[model samples]
Target chain A: MSKALLQNEVIILDELDRQIIQATQSGLPLVPRPYHHVAEDLGVTVKEVIRRMKAMKDTGIIRRIAAVPNHYALGYKGNGMTVWDVPSELVNDLGHKVGVLDFVSHCYHRPRFLPDWPYNLFAMVHAHNRKEALLLVDTIAELLGKHDRGHDVLFSKQILKKTGMRLL
Target chain B: MDDLDRKIINLLQEGFPLTEEPYADVAKQLGIDESGLLSRLKSLLDEKILSRFGPMYDAAKLGGDFSLVAIKVPKDRFDEVAGIVNSYEEVAHNYHRDHDFNMWYVLATESPEKIHEVNADIEKRIGLKVFNMPKLDEYYIGLKLTA
Candidate 1:
């Protein structure tokens, strides 16, 4: 486990937590007082279900629970995974800038394997089309003055499956 | 959910009980009748919004390969390739990306040959190389939003 996890002492998840995570991930039913239904199914009280979910967030097991919306279903078509060869010294700064961009939904700084894959900073841009998506990436690169850096633009060819995590 | 929908998703997620009167069992707990709950569930699934309300076979348990693939479709022919690529039932969620290898998509297939065949076909049809990136390791936040 990462030192961060050890230091935080995240309680190792138990059966109840695992089942509860599975129940929520599958999709909450659309009805009045959903928690009541969830609680009954798990052989627990509605209040208990709420309490456990709350504890998950409190203890950092869960970040947040909200609708996992599908961007494609909403008709915003252009989505791209982009990589940038940010210098090791500037990776942290560039990663922050990339993360703050509205179109860049996800960003990370991965190790830059030299000679083969030199690009370390990765950013994802979602937009309406190639022109708009590329425009966002280009602008970010320009602002960072790393436009000359080696990068790859990976546009999605197809989506084989879209699923949430299974707690089992 | 206000009340009932929550019960249904919870039941499905927990792995639907095998007994014939599973609905009744669930209803007894929720203080409702089985028939009404079943009917409501049928509607939610029909909406296509609930992609699935069923158990997913464990991929690792079955020894399956799960990977995300990306390719660059020429700007002029994005629509054409998308149509051909999406035709395969294997392609689930696809989008046009902005990078040089413009097209990206996820592929989940059991055997390596099946995956390789997909690339071969896409290349033969579109005349572009697919950057097949197998997941060396996964660092996930579990990325599921629990509401």
Candidate 2:
């Protein structure tokens, strides 16, 4: 899905765009015509609802309107936080590359503290169990040449939260 | 009003009704009018204070899988790579976090098998090695944003 467009990207979020984004992302009403329900509640026409959303899409704000699965209930045993010591020059390039993979869920770049923490890149890997999680982590480290540089793997001791962006 | 907003958020986060008029019902529960509820909700959404108020499905329950992945993208070429990966139907959300591996995104599909297929396809299409790390365990998964 699309994310917040850069200001230089010629994006403008008007009132209607904000309204529809607020309506849809605030969780879909579990009805048949979700948009209709949202439009009615928001005191706007359904056509306007869709139109504004489309506008947001062109401007680059609203990402996706899909069901976010509950991984915990699926017997996924762990959430591992893995980091990679990728070259500073290619951190964004590599991060974007890794993000396209389905196995890697949430990836970000954190400041690198050398001598103490050598890993320059960070990624969150979710699996059914530790073995599978480690398999992915170790494979990533190997491919990224962790031994040659230096990296760290800190298992997600806790998930502070997991909520996507909203219009507000 | 903020207290009421917080309460509504707490209730909806737990689960939204699948009714024809869910907000009306949510308003009824809050002892407020539907229009009033909508107005307040409008303010909350406009502020970017609330992340989302939608269905949280069980992907594996519905025969699907997903994972969070990240890669170190070149600064100058972020928009380029993000455009490529975000183009994929399987990709959900992409972000440029402030760090080394700045570009991160999530993917979900109908099956674990598809997870591999999509990622592999992305690797070939992007010509980059994807570090696939699935979740091993979960300690906590929540954020008190309204507060």
Candidate 3:
């Protein structure tokens, strides 16, 4: 973990910052002066809006200011939440390896619910179809080798709700 | 998406400049005028090709608690349970997966205690156990899916 992430100190946001998030959370305006639009909406100067956003970005709250493509629309129709039942001691190492794979988007070490759920590691893989998804899973299995304890891929039946995040 | 559209998606994912004239800066790199790039982006978003086009915030870093909770809603009650679960403002993303633990959703709350509170309230309402799986460690997160 990076030092900044490990601090465990909760960075408090002032009212202005909250307003900025509320204004831009849905999306940034697609104008020539996008920040200017946000500034105008929040009743702040363009420079202040830019300054606060930059500060938030530096602190890691803003992971990145970028375009998040819909994997499905990009021809990656298949999506799988692949979970692994590797030894707890080896999970961190295995997770880092799986995470770096080009096809894997998000990977994390989460707690396991015994008996019902033995998987402790989760990685989301995307592909054009189920066949391709399985092939990518095979690559992960190959990398894991013996350390690959039993694992299962849960394909999403439907997206019940997918609002990224709402700070209401 | 055309060749230019694909190029824009690929380039923008890397990161957008936070400059005064950020769009113009990016347009220069893509060899397109600022207006053209803006129109393409608008169309992409209008078509839902790009789910979002802005800063992706980390709730934890912003002093909020989050967790991935799963529940085994009886097949008959799937939609009913989903409705009750989605009613909460804290439930950010919910999905129906092909597993015994069928319903999975993310809960984001302003305080750590709220994670449990919300889970307990949902369990009480739905009469189903909620398996709260908060991240023990984050190995990696961001990835650029090539267009």
Task: Summing lDDT over every window of 10 consecutive residues in candidate 3 chain A, give the lowest-scoring window.
Answer: A1-10
Decoy 1 TM-score against native: 0.57
Task: Give the per-residue lDDT digits (tens) of candidate 2, residues A117-138.
Answer: 5666666777887788888877
How would the docking of model 1 be graded? incorrect
Model 1 over residues A19-66: C-alpha lDDT tens digits? 776676676554545667777788987767777766766665554443
Candidate 3, A1-168: lDDT as tens digits: 322463765577899998998898888888999899999888889999999999999888788999999988999888999999999999989999999998899999989889899999999999999899999999999999998889999998899988767754
Worst ten in a row by lDDT for model 1 chain A: A66-75
Sorted into a CAPRI-style docking class, model 3 comes out as medium
Each prediction's total of clashing residue pairs, residues at least 3 apart in sequence or on different chains, is 29, 48, 0
Model 1 accuracy (lDDT, Cα): 0.59
TM score of chain A per candidate = 0.85, 0.81, 0.90
